[model samples]
Target: MVPLSFANQEFTLTTSGALYWPGERALLVADLHLEKSSFYAKHGQMLPPYDSRETLERIALAIRETGARRVFTLGDNFHDSEGSARLEPHAAGMLSALTRATDWVWITGNHDPHMEARAGGEIAEELEIAGMVLRHEAKAGETRPEFSGHFHPRLQISVRKRRIRRPCAVVSTSETSGGRMILPAFGALTGGMDAADPAILAAMQPAERIDAMLPAAGKLVQFPLWRREQNLV
Candidate 1:
């Protein structure tokens, strides 16, 4: 985990794409997409059916690593609205245990917008904490420090003549809105969007600069995507 300061709050970025808030003792993750395999299988696409279990186990490991008493999921908690019903018994048990152990908040997203907290957690459309907005998608005109997901940004770089891609947080800073960050997808089965995509840059608008961040061993790697020019009108 590497320390990152945003919205005047201290946070630790885990290599696994989790944000740990030390002050709140909270663990934040995005786009869990649980039961995604089952959702695909329903449409005649066969995939390994253990995605939910794997995701749940990772969440549990993150909690243990951070000693977090609270958990905030930035949407897409399940693959679909009915995904909760498709969770295997063991995965369901694991989820129940985690929720019971911590204060879990499921921020509704496009995929699971009308989900119920049947696995023992609170449901919310979004959350505000320490002046930072937490949501599933970035509001184009929001003028406050925000943390969100949905883009699943990834940084693709070439090292030693080999292409390497890693999940990353897309962060942008603006004089009006403070700072906004989009977290990488937490689901093992989730796909990634390029961190430098124009759509992503436009979403995090009103920014002086934008960068993709990845936590490495004792350091945070930043790849700048955009920067306001001094001579641009």
Candidate 2:
């Protein structure tokens, strides 16, 4: 099986919005939005109630596949404060089971500020373990091997005149100390924006390097993260 890029130092990142640090044998995920479908359903969208089940199932499968004994949620692991509350009992049970199997840390996200307190995991605005900064948002005027989420980075690739945008992990090649990485959304229902577009660009250096996980190519592809010529939205 083709594996995603894992940081050589302490934390290894996967294109699936997950990470693996060999030192801790931990699996990291970002923007899970576990009950996203339910959140939409509550607003009368009435999407299938299978979002939670599907998300948990995928995470579980990743754990089993990687043999990871720990799990860390970068942020936005929950759709909203009440999203988990809306979960079907079985869905909640499934999540609990996943947490029970490993050391789970639920970092705070913009949407789920109460995740740590409500969910069965430790809460932290950001964590520094083994020389890496794990946070929800990218810090301003600070650079220390930051690993974060919230950008929901996506890559736009044109395949035969058709432009296809796919959610992806963005790792910076600037820092000497393992650099930075932005995870894609792992939830089944959370919406995302293409990182290749100007509207998606923030303080990003524009000339930075990008590595996109191409499962179809069985390898991470390197690209020049050039400035977006136009904005979409």
Candidate 3:
């Protein structure tokens, strides 16, 4: 099921908990550390090397399903400077095919500010389109709404009184006057930190406006962000 929308717009930003702009026919993803597994493997951490493929596949599917013409990434597109260089041949092919026609935009993130220049896309610290601003980090002071990804938002969803701590899209209603939405990490293997994190949680209001939920196969399970103690990552 698609996640519900908070703002009334033509795009129907399906709360699939996935950041999709139906109006622009664009798919938005953030924090896709494409070669993170390889980065770890080099350090002897022994992670599955298929992360690049998996991440790209999911992104591909999302684009196809949304019929998106463009893709906007919030940041952390690569684990490090050497991430794209170490990709397995097949994974590289997958990525190549995925971006053959669609336009890709990579906003500067802390992990790789030069990603746009190095990753076959345009690079910028922030983007303003159709009255909305895009960036890697939420601007501390802004009047209009902003979209970004860095802290993968997740919630502690309760089912039958049992809590399931899972990653989710975190939107901030307080910052930017309820104009900021934090896109969840798009990396297939990336984990999230708690939305209640001091640095991240401060953006939320204590009066229960935050909507945290996990998109299960059939339902979007909702929960309060402040009540959970478990970390999303």
Candidate 4:
């Protein structure tokens, strides 16, 4: 885990794509997309069916590492609305134990907008805590400190002639209000978008600067993504 400062608050960003907020004793992860493999199988595209178990295990490890008493899943807790019903017994048991261990909140996302509490957590469309907004997708023109998921931003770079892509958090800073951030997807089966994708840049608009961040070798590395053009007098 590496320390990150955003919106004047301290957070720990784990390489596994989980964020731990010490102030709230909370672990925030995005886009679990649980049962994603099952969703694919339903469409005749068979994939390894242990995605949920793996994802849950990762989350469990993060919780243990952080000693977080609360967990807030930014969005897309499941791949589909019916995903909870399809959880294999073992995965289901794992999820149940995790939820029971902490105060869990699942924010609805486009993929799981109708998600319920069947998976042993409270369901919410969004949350406002400590002057920050937590939601599934970042809203353009939002002025508050915001944390969201959906884009699954990743940083792609060439090193020694080899192209490497790693999941990263995209953060936007503004002069007027608390900054905003779009967290990387934590799902085992999830793919990522380029950190500088236009959609992501647009969603973080009304900002002076934006960057993609990830932990590397015990240090936080930042890659500039977008910067507002300055006017010449």
Model 1 per-residue lDDT at 184 = 98
User: Over the stretch 74-183, how does candidate 2's per-residue lDDT look in tens digits?
Assistant: 88888887776777888888888887788888888999887544447677888997777888876643456777778787778788999988877666554434556777
lDDT of 4 by residue, 69-188 (tens): 999999999999999999999999999999999999999999999877776989999999899999999999999999999999999989999999999999999997699999999999
Q: What is the lDDT of candidate 3?
A: 0.69
Could you tell me which residue pairs clash in candidate 3?
3-15, 3-16, 11-23, 145-179, 192-233
Q: Candidates' TM-scores?
A: 0.97, 0.85, 0.83, 0.97
- Per-model RMSD to reference: 1.2, 3.9, 4.7, 1.4
Using lDDT as the measure, what is the rank order of every candidate, best first?
Answer: 4, 1, 2, 3
Most accurate candidate by TM-score = 4
Q: Cα miss at 142, model 1 (Å)? A: 1.3
The better-scoring model by lDDT among 1 and 4 is 4
Model 2 TM-score, 2 decimals: 0.85
The parts of candidate 1 lying over 4 Å away from their true place are: 230-233
Sort order, TM-score high to low: 4, 1, 2, 3
> Candidate 4's error at 96, in angstroms?
0.5
Model 3 segments more than 4 A misplaced: 1-3, 10-17, 116-119, 158-161, 174-178, 204-208, 217-221, 226-233
**Highest lDDT: which candidate?**
4
